[model samples]
Target: MSFKINFDSENVSTGEFQLVAEGKYEASIINAEAKEWQGQFSIGFDVEIRSDVEQKHQGAKVLYNTLYLSSTNPEYAENTEKKRNSFLVACGYSGKQSLDLDEVVKNIIGKSVLVYIKHVEDKNDKERKYPRVSFVAESKVNPPQPSGPPITVGSDDLPF
Candidate 1:
């Protein structure tokens, strides 16, 4: 008649953890927001990993590094621009420069992306680690391929 939440469970069904090795994971931007930080506009993304990353990390999530692309100060313009271009390339939009920030955010919603990331330990605390997106490309999950060519297998071919 009642239920209890098991926060003490050793397994994390959907949470964040350190990825020991460099691995590719399918993720989707669940949230993206532009904020004015220090004097510039920077966009932050909340990327959720939806792949079976070694079974234990199936629903692991991570925060995408944010960079300022627009600043009130003039000194940060050139560097910001370069970072913007790199962002586009990493997001699979290389060679296109006419896209608006809002458009980029909106267009990426619900879109699955394959990201190559690495885990880095926090400087202050060596034991703590976080996942950082190193590169991103189009998701390769869909457009499924057949396991084998069409074959007719009788029950005799199966091993019980």
Candidate 2:
């Protein structure tokens, strides 16, 4: 007996090209890690879209976000800091306590979050597009509603 491999038909992907549309998705930080390039430091996240969403792209693994922690250029450094801060705030970090960067990266893994995905054209190949996780926040099952008594409106409050 002998076995043969079919190069053309045996190991090819048959799934169609799909993109997660621009919208918010319930997701989780499946993985996280510290990254560096050209002496610049950063945190990278791998997010997975939850299967409960209505879209067909659910359960897809997507690159969530990247936070650059170190940079040589002043302006770029400042922008990176702001972006990281915003991410921390969204994650419910008060910004008052001291944070260990490595610990923070590890803690974020497996955390449920709401991810905003957007598409942008590839710089080198303008015709091609990719989904980019633009923002992330703590997952809230339901948005908050206003409390207290409802006010009664009179005709006097009406304006033409």
Question: Which candidate achieves the best lDDT against the true structure?
Answer: 2
Native-to-model Cα distance after best TM-score fit, residue 104 in candidate 1, in Å: 2.0
Give TM per candidate.
0.56, 0.67
For 60-160, candidate 1 gives per-residue lDDT tens digits of 67776565667665897786777666656656686645777787777655556676777788999999887777656677665224477798999999997
Poorest 10 consecutive residues by lDDT, candidate 1: 50-59
> How many pairs of residues collide in each model?
0, 0
On a 0 to 100 scale, what is the lDDT of residue 7 in model 1? 82
In model 2, the worst 10-residue window by lDDT is 137-146
lDDT of 1: 0.67
- Residue by residue across 1-160, what tens digits does model 2's lDDT show? 9999667767779786788788888887788898878877788888888765454577888874676776788767787777777777755687488888789888877667788888888889999888888777767654323479889999999894
Alpha-carbon error at 24 in model 2, in Å? Answer: 1.2
Segments in model 1 whose C-alpha atoms lie over 4 Å from true places: 2-21, 38-40, 52-56, 67-97, 143-160
